[model samples]
Target chain A: MAGLTKQEGLSSPVSVSGLSYAYPAARGGNSRLALNHLSFDVSAGEMFGVLGPNGGGKSTLFKILATLLRPGSGRVRLFGQDTQAARGTRKRMGVVFQNPSLDLRLTCEENLLYQGRLYGLSGRDLARRVDDALGLYRLEDRRRDWAGSLSGGLRRRLELAKGLIHDPDLLLLDEPTVGLDPGARKELWDHLGRIRGSRKITILLTTHLMDEAERCDRLMLLHEGRLTAEGTPEVLKGEIGGDVITLETEQPDTLLAGVRERFQAEAARLGEHVRIERKQGHSFIPQLVEAFPGLIRSVHLSKPTLEDVFIHHTGRGFWNEGAQQESRGT
Target chain B: MRAIAALWSRELLRFFRDRARVVGALAPPVVFWFLIGSGLGNAFKMPGAAAGVDFLQYFFSGTLVLIVLFTSVFATISIIEDRREGFLQAVLVAPITRLSIVLGKVLGAATVGLIQGSFFLVLTPLSGIDLPLQGFLWAATAMALASLGLTGLGFCIAWKMDSTQGFHAVMNLFLIPMWMLSGALFPHSTAPGWLRFVMSANPVSYAVSALQHSFGMGSVALASLPLCLLVLTGFSVATLGACVWLARDQD
Candidate 1:
């Protein structure tokens, strides 16, 4: 973390240089790489996002960073300490896994108390922290209720409280908003925003949601076990250098060929729509429709988004390959 | 120490809160003991014993061991859920050693098994066996040793498992067979030579022998009480070591 992510005098909370991981084969056959020579650094107090499609190595990266899996190669540093030999570093990382980690049988207060004890937090200090956590998450009223009895949002809030009970410097969440309604997702993000507002704690979360990715201060794109692009959402979208135009036409292949020939513009078919990137997308839309007449169904124009940047770099729609955002449990 | 204690107490607290678990761990053993012991009651007679020691009295020691065996192993089965996706995963990332995990979980199950097995002891008078307070104390000690060893063994198997269905298969095919061969349902003396050799080698057989001594019963093929204890302790330590090893990061 020291040199990889440091700029001037800032300490990187997480820095991975040339990270890779592959699950062992069940039988004697070739195993697929879950992470491939990945390198990145998360600046302190930043809400760093790892945006990727499912099976694009997000969960594997999360596990390696959380010290559940050993790195296949290269180093992962937390506050400039190697995670392989990371007993002390584990104290600094608060990880909320995609899976529910709550003891459903235990009450909310008991869950928090025991989680505090695991981090060696005990006595009056632990009790106060548990109290503070319950209060902060608006779970004070449900303190005596079983975790299983809480609604999905409340259970997630309790999970967040449990993860932060020891007050870690870096909080890692893997697909934190999974299986949540939109209201709950927004509420969870609001709570996270509140947490970040309270202190300059580094937060790194993995998500496939573009809107959620926009909330991050900065993020990287991952596909097929490799880094595709990395930057702030605005900057990544700015990299496309123009507006994006989508043509809904019956003859997408013919339209793509004719657009390339007549306008000499680069166009690619993205599923049901033919996608084109032009400096003046709105003006070009008129010429496109007039030239094609009835062949073109409709034209839509918008500013370049993170998905366009992804398509620009990866030469395929973000959902063209794996549309499902399901995590593979390793 | 605090972490392990918290984890251990959580298991006890969960068990107490769930009345079904308390009843589930206990009821089967009693039903098995009563049905089997009575069905074979008048058909059995010992070669050398106090007068009128029926099959119920003779089978009491093995039945006690069986209670601990089932209770301990069944409790440890939850370790699969913990490893796959649950609270244990959270604790696994904490600044704690693998030994803490093994000790916390194994001892929790062992303690629960001992408590539940003690409830079965109240029915010993039905066996017509003379068990004084000293005898009960000795029996409890033997039960604790049995629980600790068997629970450690359960932890070892469960640490590497990914699903409860696979664990249930192991419980049926491996653990249940282990108890059966430990002279639980039959006498080691009347067994065939090959079966006798297998019973002599089984660690639970030594546990049953220790319990027989605790209950002042006789086994023709009984190992010495001190030797039985030594074996149980060695088995517990070996299993505990294997469990910690399996729980490590690299493995």
Candidate 2:
């Protein structure tokens, strides 16, 4: 453990500087940029999240860090060593891909054993590590069972166990809870928290779920291959400095103009909803209702959330925009 | 070395666990041997000097080569599956070198090919091919080398493909023809001038010639025993080298 900290003298666990990546043109389509001059640093033993929607370049970032894809430009350093030049860096990190990497036909124990050997673990040490992983993931009873036969949650646990078998100091997971149910997702988070507490490992995960992002110690919000915001959930939400108010109206543009002209408040129309971010939102609701008595169909006000922070920075509803982009096949 | 051993064992574990894959690889060649060998018996004759040598006996050696080919191709197809399902990504990121990954997979696939090819050896007596003690050893050695070469070739192809459909296309267009022209269907001496040229150049021809010489069933020698072994070894090394090169990066 002390030797592991030797590289931790004066550097963050993970750092990216001026990183950019572009996907090559496929067939007749033009090449698309996946990441753009992104830079961030993750402290040792911190749980960090890259929060984004589909095609937001989080996956590309994950690949570059995992050393699966070379960065198109710039550099990524893990534990003060450039990832491109450091083969030893790979030995110190555990990566869990978005898709399940388990060999479905093999038993839980066999999968871990094989993974352990990939890191040069063997003899009694490998056996003990495999046993410990099975026990820690609560997979002892199912050690002999085929991985494909396990329930979805158990299989995910086995994946985590395999990733941890070599006892990597840094763990990277890409969309770890994509297909998991709420209960399983929570359980997975709980396990992650426990692992961090016990081992002091640096855990970096990417997720599109706002609730999942809220659980991170720190998060960077990505949109269209750019970082929109970076901070703890509280700090990010706090940047709004007030409540978020939404007014449902049939004529959103008209109400938006009226609110801007009459009250001189900054308001934007998003679909059928006119949104305003302001301080003292509760008191403003009455003034808003009085100004437009028959026009305002409904009014909703709430404290700032991660989504509100996203909308404040990007000026678009997260889910709706994501859905629209997906439908258009962008 | 340890990584190679681990990956090799993993391949064996997965192959044995999937009963369907094991049966699928072994059963086809046996069926083809009995049906094609018996159906085309004595009706077929060679252009060279050997007479009264039944096609069943001649095709028995071909069936052995087919077993090796089918088993190797089917075994290496798992590489495509592993890539699509994300297993290859895990291996690619591991601390092991690409050479170890290639060696492990090629050896694993070769072992499957060897086991299936050896299983076909038990039926050689039924085809009336007498195997002397020394000849059986030579034949087994030839079978193993052929298996390694074929499996390495399959690995090279599978590593580049993302879809099983693409692999199937390569199998039909490239692998099957390679086998057909390797003196598996007919002797090189009987082939036309153009086809004879192809048979002589095919690496698989050396493997088939080695097997025929070991079995003492054919007088036609496209290449000598030492030359055949050298070519087969070169074939294995070249294909394995190609796999290592292709697997050096993940794009």
**Candidate number with greatest DockQ:** 2
DockQ of 1: 0.75
Alpha-carbon shift of residue A328 in model 2 (angstroms)? 25
lDDT of 1 at B104: 87
Give lDDT tens digits, candidate 1, residues A133-251.
99999999999999989998899999999999988999999999999999999999999999999976889999988899999999999888899899999999988759989899887
lDDT of 2 at B150: 93
Residue by residue across A199-280, what tens digits does model 2's lDDT show? 8789999999999999999999998889999999999999985888999998877788888888777576677888888889
Per-model DockQ: 0.75, 0.77
Estimate TM-scores for all models.
Answer: 0.94, 0.95
What lDDT does candidate 1 reach at residue A186?
A: 94
Candidate 2's displacement at residue B145, Å, is 1.7
Name model 1 segments beyond 4 Å from true: A1-11, A321-330, B48-52, B218-221
